[model samples]
Target: MAHDPITAVVPAFNESETIASVVAYLIRAPEVNEVIVVDNNSVDNTASVASTAGARVVTETRQGMGHAFKAGVAAAQNDWVMKVDADLERFGPRLVSCLANARAPGIGLVKGAWQDPGDDMPMTRLLVQPAVAALCPALAELTAPNSGIYLMDRSRIAHTELRGNYAVDLDAMLRMAWAGHGVAEVDIGQIENDRRSPAHYSAMAHEIMGFFLDCARASSKASST
Candidate 1:
């Protein structure tokens, strides 16, 4: 089946070492119409390298994934938007599957979980998943609650407030489910990336937990009203 052209939105920060390869891989996908790289004020040559690799570059002076993504999506010209991390280039077949899942009926959001060859931070399994299960049970079904890659129908995620950093993925899931849309998770294969520092990981955990707590409070307030 033929699917609508897709715009792949990549949020990059100091990824000059691998941004070019990542953009090249995304651009090669037959389903992708354009690869928009939102350079998040990288001190490195990330923007120039990505542009050299054939991606249309946009500047998001903001230094957060959520900010970069918001800029990228807004710049996207297609109806379908796929969020990809600039450092993970193992997209090959996974890109095709994401596009297919996005085209599936009644599915407003498609999230990619790392499978064989893909590795995730301990925080994902230990914190993000369990917190969602406790506060937002509906979203606990996601195998990879912290996955960075997702294909969303533009309208479905419009105006959604994303968390600033690593918490973006978990926050996105919670928001999507809160908005009453179906979210599907798929194994997109391996993603090669270095682990973050323990301090950074802990910070991400704090944000994930905060998102859950905030959502719980919002739900409670809505119910009481």
Candidate 2:
């Protein structure tokens, strides 16, 4: 199968401090053809910085990460899309490149897997992993289903029901698997990110748990029929 060029999308919110390097990495990556930054109601100079760093900038009025990503992907000029967080400090070869290289002919979604330097992904280890094992056993091997960095083909999402919340990552993976799209994962290496307050993690855990429980209930109902 022939390879398709990828559109890199960065969903940002007041990430002026790190957005430049993020966009620069994507632009410099061999697999990326275009870089787009969706500024999600940022009060900072994220948009200007991204543009200066050689990225096309767009704005999303919505407040959630899922909304920002949807807006960026909607504006993507390429069928293959790569999206990542703007706040992370990446030091190795671009994770986008790694994900793109992992792509196979039948694979529609390529998820980025990385070791967190600070073990910040408690939600993934504790909650999301078990939910995935129960819901989609095929994806139970994924170590970072909640990772913000991933590459996906937009053409495969026509009938996939995507969530607009923090569980969006898991939602996409599960939906794509349910849609019969091949899912692949690649190790993107170690990534460093600032630690957030416990309160932030609290909210994230609540949202993720709620989404998985709802999915469990739905699955039970479907099986009972």
Candidate 3:
């Protein structure tokens, strides 16, 4: 039986150290039709390494995760898109299987969730989820609303709205949920990411809160109009 092939979209910036391995793994996946690596103007050799690893390379000069991701998805050739973090090395075939198996009718996206050993998602625990609960309640239910790895439908997500900057993941999930698309989560076990600094969390909080405020203002204006 033939199954629909998925395009793996990886948005990267200065990820030469880890990209080759990630691309190699993705290219070897039977369900993955092609790996599209969007090089976000890296000062390193991410593009060349990705290409050598069997990924179709593209460039997104805008220099942000959102811009890189949009460019990668735009170049995707499959209906289903699997987006994984370029920096993370723990993602494996199990995570891919989990996300793929979660797809069903009316589902717009599948979130690949994993336990953080350090519990260091400070922005998510402190600000993002709280703001989402107030502005986009449905999105707050997600275990990892800020998760960088997930599978989405190209047709659905390509047309979806974006809040830009660091809030791309949250923005897409919020819009999809509001658009009557079902969200599913699959536990792919533990994936330990590096601990971020206080200043990093602060910047993330600013972007996330700004997005929520924009949503609040828009909602207020809509109701009044």
Candidate 4:
């Protein structure tokens, strides 16, 4: 996989401040052949800055993280699509190397797990992972089950139906494994992110929880039949 060219798919919305830096960093990686920024109708200069920094800018008007990712993947020219957020948190060019290294193990889907030795994040401890494990045990293989950073083989996930919101990453993990693709998780080390407002955080949490509830119901029905 090291020899294979990689495309870094970055999703941004009003991320003008960090978009350029993220694109520059991704372009520095030798494995990365293209750095595409999928702007989700940003009001700022996200598209211009990303384009200036050597990234091909595209737009996803549907207004969601999942939609941005779907658009990026669809525009990818490389067989391997690496998803990186425009916030410049928990990701860099080194991520490309890690993904390529993990590919040596014959894994088609590689998700980056945030390394928190302290294990203090309530989202992981109190909510996301536990709920996912309870609803779909196999998808629990990833510690950072909802991490936005991941590298996936385009063909393996192209046919899967991705949720249009916060649940996309978790949904992808489940669908990839169910499709018989080997999934692997790698540590992305510590992350530095721009803090979102309380209201924004709450809304994201609500959507994520709702997606899982839907997943739980689907799983129950499948097993019952």
Candidate 2 lDDT score relative to the true structure = 0.84
Overall local distance difference test of candidate 4 = 0.81
Tens digits of per-residue lDDT for model 3, 97-154:
7787788888888888898878767667787778778876776677777787988876
TM-score of 2: 0.94
lDDT of 4 by residue, 158-206 (tens): 5337888878887777777777788888876677665667798778789
Q: Estimate each model's TM-score.
A: 0.90, 0.94, 0.93, 0.90
Compared with the true structure, all predictions reach lDDT values of: 0.77, 0.84, 0.81, 0.81
Under the 3 Å rule for N, CA and C atoms, how many clashes does model 4 have?
A: 0
Best by lDDT: 2
Q: How many backbone clashes are present in model 1?
A: 0
Off by over 4 Å in 1: 89-92, 98-102, 116-120
Tens digits of per-residue lDDT, candidate 1, 17-116, equal 8889888888888888899999998898998999999999999886777888888878889867888878864445666555455457667778887654
Instruction: Please list the residue runs of candidate 2 whose C-alpha ends up more than 4 Å from where it truly belongs after superposition.
Output: 159-161
TM-score ranking of the models: 2, 3, 4, 1
Worst 10 residues of 4 by lDDT: 115-124
For TM-score, the strongest prediction is 2
What TM-score does candidate 4 get on C-alpha atoms? 0.90
